[model samples]
Target chain A: MVRLNNLQKEYKGFKLNVSLEIPEGCVTGLIGRNGAGKTTTIKSILGLVKPTAGEIEVFGKAPVELTAKEKQQIGVALSESGFCMIFTIEDVIKVLKASYEDFNEDEFRNKCTAQSLPFDKQIKDFSSGMKAKLRVLTAMSHKAKLLILDEPTAGLDVIARNDILALIRKYLEEDPTRSIIISSHISSDLEGLCDDIYMINDGKIILHEDTDRLLGNYGLIKVSSEEFETLDKKYIVASQKDRFSVTCLTSEKQFYIDNYPKTVIENAHIDDIIVLMLDTSKEG
Target chain B: MKIIINNTSMVPVYEQLMDQIKQEIIGGGLKEGDALPSVRNLAGELKISALTVKKAYDKLEEDGFTVTVHGKGSYVAATDIPLALEARRKAVEEEFSEAVSKARSAGLEDDEIREILEILLEDS
Candidate 1:
């Protein structure tokens, strides 16, 4: 399990304050816009970035102070980093072999072949999808209890994204107590894979909820000004309006449907929730 | 049993799976004592999160429509004839109430709704 307690990082102009727990047996998704401090948060957990304030504990120990065995228990696939672009898959194997005690070269080779990742080409010559695939393959090749993935599916086609998601599922299957923290711009990926999700904006966690609760209960109701005025405002978590009508977010969809028979309610998808919740003007 | 899930559908994926599996049990497609696929296998085959399958299985077990033996797997629970009939009728009643709500919103009178229902029933 991973826990972040009032986790704050002070930079020259930006500050990050986050607090969340990735349970022992679930995928915890982190979603945010570019520069929303998603990478900073992941780096903090991995101890790649030093945080001026806050505690990050991975499996009850400080990430940076974790022993080599503890460190090897976690798998990481950072975007546009980790693996050198000039290195070929052969070189990657050699490096990983020397780095981790439990690196499985045969499994790595099979995964590369299964995913159609060519070993002959350097990482620089690989397509964006291939590069993404290699990062995931390398991370999964080792028996890691926790996988910290940042934008593992970004810039890839649908098939590649699916392959990565499937691999994540396989990793979870390998151990019942395994956990993962994945950040991505793709809301659908979180909607599909995550047990819980956190939305970050301005370097802070804005929303955290179980994926099922978010999908099942979150709703939006678009109504005219008069209708919006008469409706119960207590249910509104956030609201956005233009010239057309006001869209009010309700935490419970079925509650409104059962009580407000006249109002038209729409299911709130994660993407829409992100847009509405991240809208500083409205969410406030 | 086969279950189809539409990610874009308004209904949540686990809810869709729950309904489909319940229907299968009611229709005898999934026989009593027949073993269901492991959660991991089902999730992999469906290309969905294993947590979703776990949620659905949990809901099913809670509702007494399915039974899960730890270290084994889930199976359709045996139901009495009266319970099976009640399950079928309840499913129909749920759909009927939704239809009635829609008809009322559309300004259809009871008589008109009954007439359309009659015609549809005769065709079927």
Candidate 2:
């Protein structure tokens, strides 16, 4: 259970402010484009960066005040620069065993071997997929109650992503109270993994929706200027326009489909929604 | 026991799963009292969100197609034969109407469409 109430952070020109909650027993996806403050938000949650304003609470306490025992209950796998590259797998294992109270060395090594990662080899020599797996393995092997995955499948092929996803599902099955906050540029990954999704852009929270409702109800409508003028404006959440036509994103696709039967309604995917929410040229 | 889905199609994945499961139950492919896979198992097998699988399962339970015990998994429910038959008939009628409309839109005459159906029925 993670909660952010009016969380705000300032970085010169960019201001990150989002109010969201990751409920227990669900995967919450934080989705955004590059430089959209997804990493900043994750960092705030991890206590890696201090917020300029507002507040953040993880596991019912400030992230900074999270005790070592409490920290053992959380598993974090950041995308950029995981553990020291110079350390060999065995050395990293030893360090983790010393670091966390609940660290299971045998489980760690077995998972490493299961993923075909060589224990004798240094992390610097490992491939991107291997490194990704190692980071996830490191985070997951210890039975953490909350898993914070920052692009856990980034830069990996389809096979590796699925393998990691399957492992994540198994992890959830192992406990009923566990939760995850996964941020990704890959919409399909979030599409199949998340119970809820929060879209961020320009350091602002644009959309917070249940995955099923978002996918099922939201859609895109491309209509001429005349049609746009006559159409109801209540359903348009975001919009883009050109001289010939206007493409508006609507969360009430069924209403438009039934009432404006002549209009063409297209299903709005996570990717399309992100694009339209983040990119604003001509607002309808 | 198995459901295939087209992600690019208009139908939502959960709805697709619900429809396929209902059809399977009605067709007797999945018999009454048969156990459905656990939510986690199905999610892993389909490579979809557990929440999506949960949604489908919840809809099935709500519609009386399945019953789920809290700790245990879900099972196909014994159907009310009359209601099940009505549902099947409605589904068939909807499909037939769609096909007839498609044929009509393609410029086929009513007699031609009727003849095609009669020939298919006879051949079967």
Candidate 3:
């Protein structure tokens, strides 16, 4: 379980102030465009960066004050290689074993085998995907109750990505008490895995809700000019006008459908919602 | 066994899973003690996150149609569903009502709605 209350992390030209919760036993996606402060928010949760304001709690204890034993229960895999590139896989294993109390050699081996990485090779010789896998393997082999992955599948082949995701799913299944925060630019990765999603823009959370609920709540309504005129204006969210007619996003598609008998209603997707929201914010 | 997931059906993937599984159970395709695919397996097949599959599985377990044993797997439960068919029918009927209500509000008549439904049904 993770809770962030009024969290604010400041930079020279950007500020990430988001209040969110990743409930126990669920994968909560942290989604945003490039430079949307998604990585900053993840860092704050991991205590990699000190917050300028607000508070955070991971599994009921402050992330900043977590003991070494508590740290073993948390796994982190950032996009970049946090390990020394010169270290061989076996050496990294030894280092990690000494670093965490719950580090499992068997699990680490299984991870290497699952990812098909050569454990004896130096990390510098590994491809980007292999490096990312090694970082994840190291983090997950500790049997951490909560795993934090920041763009863990950014540049991997489909097979590799699926393998990693399957491993994470299996890892979570090992314990009912486990949770994960997967921050990724790929919405599809989050789609099937996350129970809820947090969409941030301009360093602020623009939307946070159960994934299914968010999808169910919004839809696209296309209408002829005559039908568009009959619909209530209050239900319209975003509208595009042309010489012919208008298209709009609506939260209450049923309301408009019931009223404007000739309008078209289409189910909207998460991607559409994100683009429309950002566009609206920019215009506003 | 017979799962209908309209990818463009405006329904979420998990909901599609839930509906199909529930229908299968009610239709007797998935009997008591039948093993459901592990979340990972189904997710991989669907090319979706295991989380989505888990959502459907969890809902099934919560509704008493399935039971998940930690580290083992999910299995259909042996329970008295005296009205399983009735319940499924009602669930579907409600969806139809909602869809029709929305369509009618947009100026479609019952016949027009039926035509669309018939087209969708034919496609399926």
Tens digit per residue, CA lDDT, model 1, A133-215 = 99988888788889899999999999989989888888877776778899998999888788789999889988998887787
- Per-residue error (Å), model 2, residue B24: 2.4
Model with the higher DockQ, candidate 1 or 3 = 1
Ranking by lDDT: 2, 1, 3
**Highest DockQ scorer:** 2
Alpha-carbon runs more than 4 Å astray in model 2: A281-284, B81-83, B90-113, B116-124
Local accuracy of candidate 2 as per-residue lDDT tens digits, A104-132: 99888888888999878899999999999
For every candidate, what share of the true interface contacts is present?
0.35, 0.41, 0.41
Going through the candidates in order, state the TM-score of chain A alone for each one.
0.96, 0.93, 0.90
Off by over 4 Å in 3: A224-230, A233-235, A240-247, A252-262, B1-4, B12-15, B33-124
The lDDT of each candidate is: 0.86, 0.87, 0.80
Backbone clashes under 3 angstroms, per model: 0, 0, 7
Question: Can you give the DockQ of every candidate in the order shown?
Answer: 0.39, 0.44, 0.31
- Write one digit per residue (lDDT tens) for candidate 3, span A1-284: 89999999889999888999887777789888989988998898888899999989887877879987888888999987478988987888888888988888887887797678987788899988788888777768887889999988888888778777777767766775678899888877777677688999999998876766655556788777877777678977777666887777877666766776666777776787787777878888
On TM-score, the candidate that comes out on top is: 1
Two-chain DockQ for model 3: 0.31
Clashing pairs in 2: none
Indicate the worst ten consecutive residues by lDDT in candidate 3 chain A.
A209-218
Model 2 / residue A279 / CA error / Å: 2.7
